[model samples]
Target: MNSAANSRMIEIVHVNRTFQRADGQMVKAVDNVSVVIKEGEFVCLVGPSGCGKTTLLQMVAGLLEPSDGGIAVAGREISGPGRERGMVFQKDSVFPWMRVIDNVEYGLKCRGVPAAQRREIARTYLERVGLGHVEKAWPRELSGGMLKRVAIATVFANGSRVLLLDEPFGALDYVTRHQLQSVLLDLWDEGGAAARRTVLFVTHDVDEALSLADRILVFHSGHLVDDLAVTAERPRSTDSLLLPDMVAIKHKLLAHLGLEKRAKPLAIVQDGAAS
Candidate 1:
């Protein structure tokens, strides 16, 4: 990778977004927020519901425009959804009418890549996500977890430099959620730093953020409250999370979520996501 590729890849400057409610009150979803994300970094945006984490992610993905300020990827200001960015939502994103392989290939097809070339790229990612055997299956035939695998494959096959995931695993069961997390990490770490994509993942689960993020951004009431770096080793485990340093980080995150007025055992904190 060249020096330019290693520089700041995402720049958000004093970005603000607001929405008007039914009663005619303008609500600010995102306040004056600014942050820089380096290339190839896996970052998590953590906060309770309606804290503007998802709203901020949408702005970065160019699915929604900010009321003021600006967001840029690489060096260009984002105007709308572009091929360089891809997003996966909490809800099922797979097309019900299309076969698994077709859904994975949709983005490439839209880009008008040669048919043979796109199919190969699609197949490669599908296999990487462990969905190769189901390429001909329908969305209805796949379980919730499998459907997410398809979505992951689609985003990667599209060759997006930035990946925005809005609680993509929030609805899954505990076991399945962890399994999918492993799959995501493996794919994200598959290549050299230059070949990796910059990921911004949003979740309310403190444990999830601790497990996946190189750094965690804590938001509350539409404000950037804290930005903490997770220095724990990669492939963090249940036991490692119980270590003194990791527990301290958990306490700090719980504090930001307004859940640590009184100190509690690490087990209690790990039991559930912040509410």
Candidate 2:
């Protein structure tokens, strides 16, 4: 709640990631990206496919290393994976062998929480994500949406202060996606006072960012193309897209991604056809 926390959670300073293609060419998946996300901010990394949005989020999650520069959280360098940074990937990363409650408590157990306490914590988080009744259900038994809820519950239940999500709900249907987005907002509520968890969400969907993010960082061609602030008020829904501010943000993102719709000049079309 302090002024300092109104900004500055995760800092990616001049970060870069490079890879060697099968053709023996060096490609920079991410290039010289510098950004500081505010604490408790719902920030989205928006961009086209292969633009390195996922690469950057994985770096933040410590699942991948930056080839140059560094990423730090709360002033400490991110050397490797830490318990404080939790990640939810695009696919449902649930353990198919584990039941819903067991999956939720998996992190807690790994961290050495006591048996009874871990179970209670798992149940609590399951309830939080509206899957309490399915605690004993297997992963295969649940629908796609339910599996994602289990993954989300596991991340939050682990008490991670920085949530790094790479299209966590990307596989769900429209109805399920909206439902879970609202659920996430309710659970992430300013992250509370003493323990505010910051979120860095990666998505190519403009409407998703508009509905969920406080800021949208547009990534393209392995670079940070634009940084836009979503001024829309919270408790936001897709209806906010009707607002001029939301429309402008969407336009900016599309234009940056080279996805903007434009009118074709009649002269050019006629000349090409004639030729």
Candidate 3:
């Protein structure tokens, strides 16, 4: 395939997801969505609760099959989980019993990578995420931010070309969240070949989505209500130029939830003046 074709890392074609409740009613979580995620692109899914942002991520991760349509990564259909994609969920899914290095090596070990090579890879990624000093620390010994760093290092060590982040920083406090975001961006930039990893981040925080995403996809009532490209330069800072767009998108999303008055001007005004 040409470079242009190779650039498309993921494709969602006419996808729909519906679940039958025990009460015999159908709940559609995603509706007729089609999108293409290019290689190295950072895409975020954001919307109100119950819009199926997480469900959509799960579908792309091949954890759940769409009720209709298809999802493909690197031009191949995704029927099941594979090493091509690594996922970090809302919770720190690390094994509490395992030390930090052990958790980072787990995936490589499962894949039959030699112990020496796995350790080397784990060390490299741990250092990349600023966790090199805590190689022997157990999950319980680490702070929430530290644990999240370990989880990120673990996933990156697997050498996956696509990353599925389901609100990895959702539970962290403001300072911790900002710190992790910076670390994530640095790692994403420094990964070199791995740097081309296409990322699909799901978050309810509009600021987080706006700050990190190359593009943002808004979900409303199981349908893709908006696909907005973020034309800002890389290493994005949280600034007024971006906030208005984010707030505008948030308001548009709110309207889909039957809320009135999209975009709170007072909030925007205060934020802008403070900046």
Candidate 4:
């Protein structure tokens, strides 16, 4: 393992977040959660709907505050959003009024990166995401998948150390989802081991988590339930899930979601042929 992988990047110490309901009830969205993620690590937060996975991710992104405890990234406590973090939501984050290249350049522009340099950076990432040809196109002109690619390129161009993705591909079709996942993985791995950014991806799909995560953190009813390490080698595929270790992890995750995989019935055959 590299030195970056050994250094702690994110620390959540006994964090808790709660919200008051209109009915005069207080609900704990995240309860006493604590975890440490190393620099360059890809960690997935997974749980069923309303299980507080997203809530915990938002706290790390500085979009929401924990009612108690603290979250520190790179040793500094996070009070609000910062340039060190970039978040991509499930919804389309591309600006309809801006051209694709401009959308990708927006973050750089905000940080006062020189126009020429930022434009070059934006173009580079656009090409990386396979959107170089559509740089001049408006968000409204692009398909849903294309728009998502634009959003992704934008965050990478901004050069954040930590990437917070909240089900960014959840709304896409299966094929598109798989394609986007590959795109994300390619970009993430492009920087090589030493330059890799820390990623905290929140997803409800167990397969998605298994495919991308170096570590999987399971949440249930606003509490951290399971923390499992995935030692499986990268460039994993659908068949990876069939491995004994991966299968066992999947079973545990499904059980947390109140689900169980059923055994497939064997097909009848006669004389080694279908009946």
**lDDT score, residue 248, model 3?**
71
lDDT order of candidates, best first?
A: 1, 4, 2, 3
- Write down the lDDT of every candidate, Cα atoms only: 0.88, 0.83, 0.83, 0.88
Residue 232 error, candidate 4, Å: 1.0
Candidate 2: what lDDT?
A: 0.83
lDDT per residue for candidate 1 within 1-275, as digits (tens), equals 45564577888888889999999999999988888888888999998899899999999999999999898888788999998898989999999999999999999999999989999999999999999999999999999999999999999999998999999999999999999999998989898655778999999999999888888988877888778888888767888788788888898899878887736422211111111
Query: Residues 1-275, candidate 3, lDDT per residue (tens digit)?
Result: 45765677888887889999999999999877778888898898987889888988999889999999888888888998888899998997989999999999999999999999999999999998888998998899998889899989988999888899998999999999999988888878775644567899999887787788888887877777767787676777756435666677656645544566644321110111111
Of 2 and 4, the candidate ahead on lDDT is: 4
Off by over 4 Å in 2: 1-7, 190-195, 261-275
lDDT of 4 by residue, 56-162 (tens): 98999999999998888887789999988999989998988899999999999999999999999999999999999999998898999999999899999999989
Candidate 4 Cα outliers beyond 4 Å, as residue runs: 1-6, 261-275
lDDT for each residue of candidate 2 in 51-158, tens digit (9 for 90 to 100):
899999989988899999888887678888998899988987999999899999999999999999999988988998999999998999999998888988999999
Model 3 RMSD in angstroms: 6.9
Span of 10 residues, lowest total lDDT, candidate 2: 266-275
